[model samples]
Every structure is written in C-alpha cells, then in structure tokens.
Target: MLPDALPSRWYPIFSSAQLRRAPTVVERLGERLVLWRDAAGRAHAALDRCPHRGVSFKTATVNQAGELVCPYHGFTFSPKGPCAHAPVLGRDAKPPAMSLDIRNVTEAHGLIWAFTGAVEADTPPPPWFEGLGDDLRRCADIAEEWPVHHVQLTQSMLDIYHVGVLHRRTAPGSGQVITDFTMTTTEDEVHTEGRLGHEGAKGMPFVARLRLPGLVHLDVGFGLHVLVGVTPIDAKRSWVWARYEARLTPLPQLDGVIAWLGAKYDFTVLQHMEDLPLLKSIEPAVPEPGVDRLIAPDAGAAAYLRLYRRALSGRMEVAQ
Candidate 1:
C-alpha cells in the first residue's frame, strides 16, 4: 500500500488527447477512476464503479444528454456525480438518494489534472512552468508506466549526479563530476543549479526545479525544456508523463521539427537506453529516509525528500 499520508495536491494523470468521447478507465493514486468527455468536450472524473450495483464503470457509456449510463442497468449519472435518472424508477420518478464518487478534475497544459486533496471553494488551479506559454510547441508527449514507486522515480529525477555516470554511454564526453552545485528550498519548491564538470573543459550549466507533488522542470539550455509529472498508479507502480517542448527558431511553423529532433536524440536515448534499467534495479522500490547515505551531490534530492515528508504530514501548504 502507498503511504497513508500522501500530500493533498493536484496530479496530472492522463494526457488530454487520450480521453475522448468514450469513457476510459485508469488506475491512479491507488484508485480506479473513470474519465470521460461530454458533448462539449469537457472532461469529468469519478470512481470507476456504479453506485447502485457496484459494477465497474469501465463498461459504461455516455448518453446523448452528456450523462454517464451504466451498462448493467439504465441508471444515469451527471458529470458532477449526482444520480440523474433511473430507468427502473420511470422517467419522471425522482432519482434515489445516491451519487457517484465524484473526483475534482480540470484540463490544462495538454493534460488532465485530478485533485487528490479535499475539494474546497479555494482550490487553486494546477501548477505549471512559468514560460510554457502558447509560443512554445510540444514536440513529444510520452507516457510510460514504471514498476518502481513514484518516490524513487522522482528522487532519481532530482539526482543530477547520476546523469554523467548512468548515461555515460548514451551521452559520451559528459563527465561524471558535478561542481558548483547549489540548491534552494522554498515552501513548496526546490530549485537546483549546477555544472557538470569535464576534463580540460569548462563545466556545462543546468537548472532543475521541482514543484510539490511531483512536477519537474529541467532546463539544459539550447531552448529545450522538459516537463515531467510523476504520478503513482499504486504503491509499486508509477506513470511518468514527459512533455518535450522547444522554441528553437523565430519561425513557429518549425517548432515541431525542432522539438521532435531534441526529444528523439536527448529524451528517448537517455531515458530508455540508460535511466530505466538503473531505476528498476532500486531496492525496496520505495525510498526511506534513513536507509541510504546521501552526499553533497544529492543536496537537491535530499531537500526534496524533506519537503515531501513535510507535505505528507500536512505540515505545509502546497503552493499552486
């Protein structure tokens, strides 16, 4: 089982393009959820079970009225989860005092975000990278399921020291030494700036930042930006959503080509050829505070762990 105290925040679980008019089922945050779109193309999320018969909503269908209809019976539910109609009770009969388990969801940044925390009147919009505006075009949108816990996967993303060593083959000439590394932690964010040292050469500078609840932004220069969302499918599995974007030239029409090339060479080669193998080999799958020895090079990851613990304990408010 996952930790009982997971931080209450919004998590991006599905790509916007993946959810169409048909109802789709997904396992996220250790719960089975049903996602669907209405006639107007808006998205809705709920527990993947019918309230009346406990039938899985995986086989449900969307009615013309934009309500979800259970396949077993004709019981219907609205996007917000209220029982809209019951075929057995007659068309004019009032619906029973029942409701589907509704989940708060919204669409932004080409992804569907679900609120894991309690829904309140003041629930904020999903967090996003500052410069990811309409000007930048997405080149690659990839989603992969990893067999390791989300905590470990997220920690690996923050651990910059592993790049030069683990990706040495794919990224030859990149040295294993890290120099001039500095990390800063705010209420709900951790920012790390560092340089990768190489023999007889000036180090390469990079900047990485993490937002609470598993949002990461990595900038390695050259107008390429990588954004990743690490969402837990369960205690032992995680879904990683990676978006590669670029604004290489003044011609917006050529943005896609630039982004595609960058993702093909950098993201694909590094993640598949080098990262996944090492990530799957981590022991215990989940990370424990005192189980491993962390060094100076791991300052960013260490700070993230501390902040994550605090968030899980409900001691800090997650910034939007």
Candidate 2:
C-alpha cells in the first residue's frame, strides 16, 4: 500500500534491470517523477515535470548525451536537471534555466535506492539480516497495487499468530502452538519487530527469523541475507519487489534451494488475496486524529503504524 503521503525513509524504488535503456516515470501517491540512465550508464531520478511547460519529461526522448528531452517542446535537461538546450535554439544559444530535485541515487546489491526526505549519507545503514546466504533465484514477482495504505501491508509481516490460521502452509498449526518467538515493541512508529527462529528448523537456512518487513529479511546464517521490497505504487496500490542477495557464495550455486524457498514464499499473491477482502472491506478509515488503545499483538503492530504515521506526517509538512 502506498500512502497518500510520502515517507522520509530511503526505500528501494526500482531494480537495476528496470532502470536501464529508457526513461520511466513512476506515479506514486499522486506524485510524478522520472528515472533514466545517463550516458555513463548511471541511473538518475529527477522531478518529471518540464519547467518549460509542466509536461512530463518521462514522455520525452533520450538524446545522444543520454539526457532526457521533453517530447512536447523538445527541451533537453541534463542528469543534473539543468535545461541543457532547447531544440529550437542552437547549442551555442542560451539554454533553459531550471533545475529539479534530483535526489542522490545509489545502486547496490543489484538494486537502486532513492533517498527520500532529508536522509544523510552518513546515516547508519538499515538493519542487518542473518542466515542470509547466496543462491537466491528470482523466480516470479508478486507486484500489485493496493487499495489501502502501505502500512497495512507492512504490518502484515510481523503477524505470527496469523501464520497458522491465515497462511496454512508455512506455520500450519495442527492444533499445536509453534516454538517460542521473541517480539519486542519499542517507542517508535515502527511498531512491530519480532522474530521466530526454530533451531534445526525445516527450510533453507535450518532456522528462519524475521529480519525486516515486506523485505522478509531472513538470516539463514552469517553473511546470508534475503531482502524483498514491497513497494507502493500509490495510496491504493503498490508493488511487491523482492531479491535474493548472495554475500558469501554465488547465488547460481543454490538455484534449486532458492527456487524452492521462492516457491515456499509464493503465498505473496495469496497474502494479497487475504488482504483484498479486508482492505477493500475497509470503509475509508475514520480519521481519529490519533489512535487509541492497542492490544497485545497490537503492540508490535502499533509501533510500525506509528513509525509510518510520523514518517508520512513529516513528509506532508514538507510538501505543504
């Protein structure tokens, strides 16, 4: 679920594969922006609007310089976003004077990340995953647009009790409770952060634990991290983007297991189906300035919900 607002967090927006060749515009939360690769083969994100006529640069052409040229009036802008030239005017002539909020773009571990809000390069890295090893294969992508909020989907990750009742395969409880799980709730809007690691567990890593939301970061062992990004397309829809990162060994080596694990997690679509009835069933949440009391499992759920609420609030303030 993409929020009606934006978060100041740095999230994975696109994979390296999708950002190649031509420019692509992602419309999210009622906002428009463009992503394209430069001549040096570096991916760049910039405000999609052409300062000249407010036309989208995403619909423009990629020039020999690899800069995005607006299709409407043929206005070309550099990766830095300064209008490099106006086709009607010769190169020697004065170019359009404008710039876009070209955020810093970084490609890592086969993914492209865009820093939203006031993220600092010096900021500490995101959480570290365990049991993460090589051999993660990209079998199928379960990307869909949600008709609800992004937090709704994120909160679903830390839901352990529902595993047995909702998702029957992974943690099917034959009327028996699973092993002990450690769930911690802190004073952060990031409500839920818990882990259920069963030793000699049945699966790829022997024991699996929750690492991150939507990411499904499960550390199978040291240096092995499987991260999946459940990106939002808008307040009503989003995409489920996942990747298997190989840190110690090459992924090609464990294609079979990775494929198996990928299949194991194939319930993403099913998960959405589960959410469909609930999300669509939600009759536009009642704006209660703030939430009231929360239950036990709700403790973790509340933390994440609050984390996202604050994040969206900070963004809305800035956008205003």
Q: Scored by CA lDDT, what does every candidate get?
A: 0.81, 0.55
lDDT of 1 by residue, 1-320 (tens): 14532555889989998899889999898889999999899999999999997999887899887899999987999998889888898888757678999988999988999987777889878878777633435457778888878888888888766777887887676687777888999978999988886865677888888998898988766677778889899877898988777767777658777776767776568877678777788897656787878888888888888888877777344432
Q: Residue 213 lDDT in model 1?
A: 84
| Best-fitting candidate, scored by TM-score | 1
Weakest 10 consecutive residues of candidate 1 by summed lDDT: 1-10
TM-scores, in order shown? 0.91, 0.72
Mark the regions of model 1 whose C-alpha exceeds 4 Å error after superposition.
1-5, 133-138, 264-268, 315-320
* Model 1: number of backbone collisions: 0
lDDT, candidate 2, equals 0.55
Give the TM-score (vs. native) of candidate 1.
0.91
